[model samples]
Target: MVKLSNTEIRKLDDAARAGWLYYVAGKTQDEIAKKLNISRQSAQRMVALSVSQGLIKVRLDHPIAKCMDLAQKTKKSFWFSIV
Candidate 1:
């Protein structure tokens, strides 16, 4: 298990939202956990917590093809890298 701070937990909350979105979109918990660099159990728990905590909304928007695109672009523009 990994130890996390309140801030880190909040970040994980965002991750939880993203992970839940992916899972609800059909990806497996293992896949989401792998992507998030955590355990499958953590992924499932966080995703569920996000839903239980009302941190995420279940909306069916057209898959935003530019979501990751904009993320990458913002990274480049701001010289902020993830990883």
Candidate 2:
């Protein structure tokens, strides 16, 4: 891992806060920018940086079993290929 200088650490912290506000708090980028006292473009960049630095994590939960069963039934009943 690369060492971060104090300024870099502060920037990362700001980015993480911006990301949390946008993702978890459901704030708009404009709102985040206003709240953080930064420009909209800066807020956008901070959010992206937070994601790139692994400060943000995203998980998608899918019902694969249910979907597969429904697809199989549909294919059997309709004789249609589901690819």
Candidate 1 TM-score over all chains jointly: 0.47
The candidate scoring highest on TM-score is 2
Q: Would you list the clashing residue pairs of candidate 1? A: none
Which stretches of candidate 2 lie above 4 Å from their native place? 64-83
- Candidate 1 lDDT, 7-80, residue by residue in tens: 97886676666556565677787877777788888888877777776776666466684686788898999998
Every candidate's lDDT: 0.74, 0.95
lDDT at 61 for candidate 2? 69
Q: Assess the local accuracy of residue 63 in candidate 2 as a C-alpha lDDT between 0 and 100.
A: 83
lDDT (10s digit) by residue, model 2, range 1-83: 99999999999999999999999999999999999999999999999999999999976567886788899999999999998
Among residues 3 or more apart in sequence or in different chains, the pairs in candidate 2 whose N, CA or C atoms overlap within 3 Å are none
TM per candidate comes to 0.47, 0.73
Top candidate, metric lDDT: 2
